[model samples]
Target: MPNEIPSRQELIDRAAELVPLLQKNALWGEENRRLHEENLDALTESGLLNLRVPTRYGGYESDMRTVVDVIAELGRGDGSTAWVMSVFAISTWMAGLFPDEVQDEIFAKPGVRVSGILSPTATAVPAEGGVLLNGKWSFNSGVLHSSWNTNAAVLLTPEGPQPVMVAIPVADLEIVDDWHTAGLRASGSVTTVARDLFVPEARVLPMGPVLQGQHRSQANADSPVFRAPFMATACATISAPAVGLARAAKESFFERLPGRKITYTTYENQAEAPVTHLQVAEAVTRIDEAEFHARRAAGLVDANAAAGKPWTLEERARVRLDLGSVCRRAKEAVDILNDASGGSSVFTTVPIQRIERDVQTLNLHAILHPNTNFELYGRVACGLEPNTLYV
Candidate 1:
């Protein structure tokens, strides 16, 4: 049977429905240290994996708002699932940045899934009709199920080592199971190693031009989603998941309030306590703030893309600032919820504890780190160019 492509709302609703199932399998995924097969099956069946594929290839060709909404919904279920989906969707969107021939072959695969890391951690030495890739890349989310992987490497050229983006089949690389971490453990973000592997020249996309809004694909030039500033949209995509995770934490904290008693206190119901009231108000407000910043960032990026405008320095800096704020505020909200949930919340069996850890991990990410982005934004606000290559 052919897969039915869903409307954006339908896909978002489907993701919401999967929350309970994802919660049920969350422990299994954590224990196994990879995305649960059941969760992956459900995601694939729902057509969520095709959210960013071109419409001509039976995909939804979803926009940034839909991407944020769907991933955020999934984050409420399992952070790992949501994280993997965010990476997959972003990488799939990048396929449209490649030349028509590359996009044609990549999207041709049935139920195509792509995963990637944009950091140029590998080296590509020039070779006949291609380049020889020899290095390793880490934090490759969703590597386990990907059909193709987009990697960034410094190309050995006469001028200098020009960093470029290349898409290669998963069958051509080696997967190293080194993703053991404190949070987002189920994401299976293992390392990929390629030694002396030949990647065809046609598969490479120049990173410099793409970052500057110069694209090689005439086929997708008219697509708003394809024309957006790459790094800004990418950061926004990952930032949305943290908002959903924080919301889950808030909901879990409140749901247990009705029957709970203040520990070693005279209060019979925690819900009636003034402290509980204040904590709930504070956490909920923080979550709202986080969601506001995330949505704002997504809106700005999408609007620019729709208008076919290049991002000014301030616009790019603000997106990073907004993303960092989202992660910071989300983590802070989860922390408050954790404290409010009492001692039991720290147990391994408790979902809130896991959510807390995942949000902390999310904040620790270099891309989402509050301090780093703040500094970068500060630099740009001071009328200086930010040193980061991503913008």
Candidate 2:
């Protein structure tokens, strides 16, 4: 049977329906420093894991907007779960950029999960049939639950050090259970070590071409879902989780607002205070702005993909700006709400504290850092070239 591409709303609804289950298992994931099996099962069963898989492989091949919406919905449930899902979505889309044979091998299994990291931390040396991969990649989200990992490595070439993306089976690499973190603990983003691992030439892709939308996959050459520049799509997809985190903060705050009182104050109802009103209004506005940036970024990717348009430097920078803006605004919103929740919100049972930490972690990411993105966009706007190629 052919895979039916669901409407955007249908996919979002599916994600929305899984919130309770995700919430139910959030604590378990946090406590264990990994996602619960129940959460993974729910995501796989919901078809959310297949959002970015190739259509020929029974996956949805959803556009950026649909991808963002679904991820945001998941974020509304659990930050770590949503963070891992976003990584899977990006990695699966990257898998589509590989040769058709590789895609067949990867997507052949049901509910395929691919985790990835963008930094070229590993080195690849030429060997008989392929290259010998060696080095360690940290912050490999979803690696513990993934079948494959799409990692970046520097390949020695006559021209110079050429960066390439390599797809390796998780079993082939050594996993380090050192994922202790203050935020997104459940994501289980442990470090993976590749000790002289052999990578076939077929599974290796040059990063330069892939970044510019010039990929080796003839099979997916005309696929609209794979049309946009890699960074643009990634920035757009990653930004959605921040919006989700902000929304989750909002939900957590309002859920506890009605009966709550201003501790050490005469106000019987915290919601009745003018300061509370201001905080709510400010947080809600920031959340709205974060969503606006997220949707705009997704819209840019989707529209460009559909039209097959060339990306201007400013436009590329704008995607990064959107990512930074979403992270900044979302974190701000979460902080506001978390602060308003008072001392009681610090309890393990409260979701706002976790959401706050998750948003802060997001803001600290090198690529997603608000100030870095803002500077990049400003540089481009001022007629200067972008400092990095990842834009």
Candidate 3:
């Protein structure tokens, strides 16, 4: 069957229908740690997974805000699926940032998909047209659904030193199937390996310099699609699901409040108690704060792109910090909400337990790690040196 291009609303609507099934299967996805074929087909057919590709290659090319909204909505149902889709969709956009010839080769087929685990853990040897890549990439979310992947490789040429993005055909790469985790377990994030794979010159892109808004791809000269710093803003995609899971936690906590019994208390319903009010309000308030900033970062980045200027390093760091902060706040809020449930929310059938673990798990992402991002932002702001060039 052919993949169909869907409007932004259609994707949201489709996600609306699928979320419930996902919610029912949330634990199943977590236990399996991989997306089910049924859900993959639905997303692919609806085109929810194709937002970032260029219009010429059959993508929606919608702004980042729309993408955030859709992914957030999906997150409210299942954290794993949302995380995978967000990364996959963003990688599609990142592909546009590659050279035009690279784009032509990768997206030559309609509705083709791309997924990556952007750890930059590969080696690139200078070859005739491009570089021969060899190394392993881990945490490749949506690995099962993608036809191609963007693997980060350090450019090692006799001429000089450089960092590069190497496009690898999914068929040529090997999956290590080693993803085992407590949170976002459904992401089935496996490791991919490539050894001495031949890549054309245009297929390899410089990492450090191009991320600052210069690239060999002249096709992007006429379009602002590739003008934005999709790398620094990367955490936004991962963070959106945390916000959504927090929202779900808030909702689930409230739905049970009216009829919940308090351990040994005379009152059978906890909603009437003052402690319930305090915890619920705190959870709701924090989740609201998370929502605002998550949207704020995406809106600001998209607004800048629409304005024709590229995203700055500070702004990029801000996205990283803000995203990490939001994820942390969301998890904290949910923790409070979980406490409000006494002991019932801890059961296997309750689902809150899954969400709680998922939120905590998302906190471990390198880009979304609060302490690391805060220190990076703090250093950059105070005129100290940053640890990594990417974020």
Candidate 4:
């Protein structure tokens, strides 16, 4: 960590410079099923890992727009790296929801990278000083390089099981290398298991209120970046990377267009064909549309945070809707580019293949899926409550 925090633009510019290196590491990361150490070093050195940390704790304390923009730049380089960074970045924000004491202990140290899953998949029974937690959480992105894992467990009270968040050191949890997937392989989003681990009461945070815009980081109480409603901004954080992946596909396609010829066609070069022109136009428009929705959702999240008010149900639902649109359009744009690039583009060596696979995986995410969010939004629009708990 540096004594002086870099400006938001400085952070974005730094991420832009790292694109090539990230791209270079993409294949190795995929092979090893984790991010290369060099990529981690680059992210740490650039201060991008601390994008959501508090300024008082040597973090940039960037707004939602800046955070998403930085992630977008990283996405342009490599989808997996951007996905991991986005997950860890939001995990840092989630850390602020912990008690002030817990925040001090975690953020007071430098190079504190945290990763987590929001699902309450474990059970927390009352103990002497804390609670005994036992559960297994899957899809914990960036867990390999993380210092801590912030997860949720159901608290067993007399009434019933109430969900609560807990931050546990990486040393205490068991990492299960079960992340065998065709896409986003470098993310290392594996399963994490905790058996009979005791978490101090101080580390416990109420999940329901946190989603409703309540947090306990007194050091960040005055910062609008930390005051944002967790659920309202959650979709924007993950969806921004999809938009970036679309942009990466666009760049990759054009770069390969110069000498490429349509096989057995009248046009010598693919770029010279009228059909190619239409493909480019449609793909670019779809990419732009995805970016538009992503930016709009991010702006709304920032505005709501700046106001320090809870987001209404309608507002939160709209964010989800916007994120769904972003995911749908981004994947479609990448598919168009992939198809336009011809059969050669599907080769493993071609960057478009990986980009296509990554965008498809991203679109399948439960929260960002078009149909799921569309249904959720429609339920809310019809004067009915949402079926899911997060919103």
Candidate 5:
């Protein structure tokens, strides 16, 4: 790692350079149901893992635009890798929102990795110094390789049930190897069980304030990169993988197009067929649209952070809209390309099948689902109160 922060373009270039390595490890990652060790080492060496860490901790503290760009480049290589990295970026940013002392503890390690999920599936009770937390959080992506987890849980306060984010070491939780899935298999998003785990008060952050851009970290308060709303930043960062996956499908399709023929048809060259032309055109268009939405969403976050502007309800809803649009468009692109891929594309050796599955999985995510996000945006646009606090 360099003593000085790298420029946005430099970080993006580093990510692009890791594409072949991530691609090479994709199959192995899928087979073993976790990111390859070599992939982890490569990410650490690239300093990409520290993208969202505070500058005082030797991290770049890059803006949201740079974050999405780097993640998209990683997505072009492997969707699982991209997804895991995206989660890390979001989680690390969340870590920065904690009290300064907590940040010091978490960011002190070299090449620290933190995995997290927003769903408050656990419960926390008052304890001596902090809270005694216990519950199970599923879909904890990258947990196996992570040193910490910023999990959400419901706190049993005297006032009632309060949602809170608790930072806990990975060793304190019991790992369950249950990440069997048709898509994003390499993410290692398994279930983690926390049984009577004691978390210090410094490690527990109230979610309500954090969601509204009122973070507790005095040290990071003035930092532009940490000024944006949490959900907006998260939505922007997570949307990048969809765009990259679409591009991956396009790459896979065009790479194999020259030698491929329309089987059982008169067309000797698939690329010459009018239907192929239409499919290619449609897929390319959707991919471009996906990129457009991704960039717009990231731009919104970056601009707001730099200006220190408070996010309007409509703007927040629109960020969610952008996320959904990216997922929907990217999936559409991958579907068009996958449909055109034919039977040979089903082989494990082919990249399109994996890209298709990955995009499909992303679209199905609760937060990333196209229909849910569209409905939320539409509701907010119609002058109704947002149904969820997540936005």
Candidate 6:
């Protein structure tokens, strides 16, 4: 339970009660390829909607592991719900690192949800008191239910070019509605367009020093809350959903095993076969192993943050390693389960196919891109500069 560790367990307990409903509701998400309003309400009532909100704003301010467990539970039933909640809710915390003005503007109201697209696809021109921003953000997850959106933008001045993430109110922009994808379709990861929107000085935070451990939030000044880098924690949130989906696949396979027969074999019940035992064991093992790795990484993160020490590059890179490995393990577990599930595993009635498709789509995310993170960790281990700032 979430409360058993760094977060309150009551929240997760409440969330668990909704699992069957969410499992039933998952199809609506897959059927329409978009998160339905009912799914939104279910999550909101489950306390997941506010899991990442700062305690100062009537939220749990939960630890990463608690968040992980909660998400894993949701993901076990529906990867789409889990993935959307992971990205959207974690970004809610990311919004807290901004200046108080921006933070107040975004979270001051009730029922407000924030969505972010970090791709640097915009240009900001300096104005008297603020910057004039114009750009389009791709993969704006949770845009449909969000009241605010943050986008990464580049600042071009006569002096030079610099990068900054600008938090923009969704009211200031237009939705492009282009979120066609194979997996995580319910994310509603549409594109947002902003043209010549004049942003106030208080609304924008400079990029460089803040990421290197400097922050502007008065509440964050001495608090380690803002000190934790998003990159290191980001994957833990993303990968938990994968672990949950794999768990779902395993359960679905077992549930259908007794009713189905092996195509080429004389087995009437797959569960009674020795090979079924072997494959099921392998899948369950892989899923458990992934959870262990994720827990290790998440524990280190909370420990260091609680102690007020900024995680060193070594530690951060290690977290990246843990993240990539967990994703691979989760996928492996699902593949094993699907294989054991036989040809019928892909039927529209079988949840294995959905879990399989979900894992495949989730694996390709830029944040979880296996080869890239692995190489970054390798270079770091051998004493090389990080391949990118994300590490």
TM-score (all chains, Cα) for each model: 0.97, 0.99, 0.93, 0.97, 0.99, 0.94
Residue 140 in candidate 6, Cα distance off native in Å? 1.4
Q: Residue-wise lDDT of candidate 6 within 58-92, one digit each (tens)?
A: 66667777878888888877888888888776678
The CA-based lDDT of model 6 is what?
A: 0.78
lDDT of 5 by residue, 337-372 (tens): 999999999999999999999999999999999999
**Positional deviation of 6 in candidate 4, in angstroms?**
2.8
Any runs in candidate 2 off by more than 4 Å, and if so which? none
User: Which 10-residue window in model 6 sums to the lowest lDDT?
Assistant: 1-10
Error at 58, model 2, angstroms? 0.5
How far off is residue 42 in model 4, in Å? 0.3
For each candidate, the alpha-carbon lDDT, in order, equals 0.89, 0.93, 0.79, 0.89, 0.94, 0.78
Residue 382 lDDT in candidate 4: 99
Q: 1-391 in candidate 4: lDDT tens per residue?
A: 4558777789889999999999898889888999999999999988898888877777778888888899999999999999999889888899977888898888877878989888889999999999999999998999899998889889998988888999999899988989999999899999999999999999988787788888777777788887777777678899888988999999999999998899988778888899889999999999999989888999999998887777889989998999899999999999989998888877777899999989999989888799998898999999999999877
The 10 consecutive residues of candidate 2 with the worst lDDT sum are 210-219
Tens digits of per-residue lDDT, candidate 1, 214-295, equal 7899878899988888888898899978998998898788777779898899999999999988888899999999999889
Better of 2 and 3 by lDDT: 2
TM-score of 5: 0.99
lDDT of 3 at 20: 79
Candidate 5 stretches greater than 4 Å from native? 1-3
Q: Spell out the clash pairs found in candidate 6.
A: 3-7, 3-8, 3-9
Q: Compose the digit string of candidate 3's lDDT tens values, residues 113-220.
A: 788767789888887776788888888888777898887888876778677787778999988989888778888889888888898887787877666756666666
Residue 121 of candidate 5: its Cα lDDT? 98
Candidates 2 and 6 compared by lDDT, better number: 2
lDDT of 4: 0.89
Better-scoring candidate (TM-score), 1 or 5: 5
Q: Which consecutive 10 residues in model 4 have the weakest lDDT in total? A: 1-10
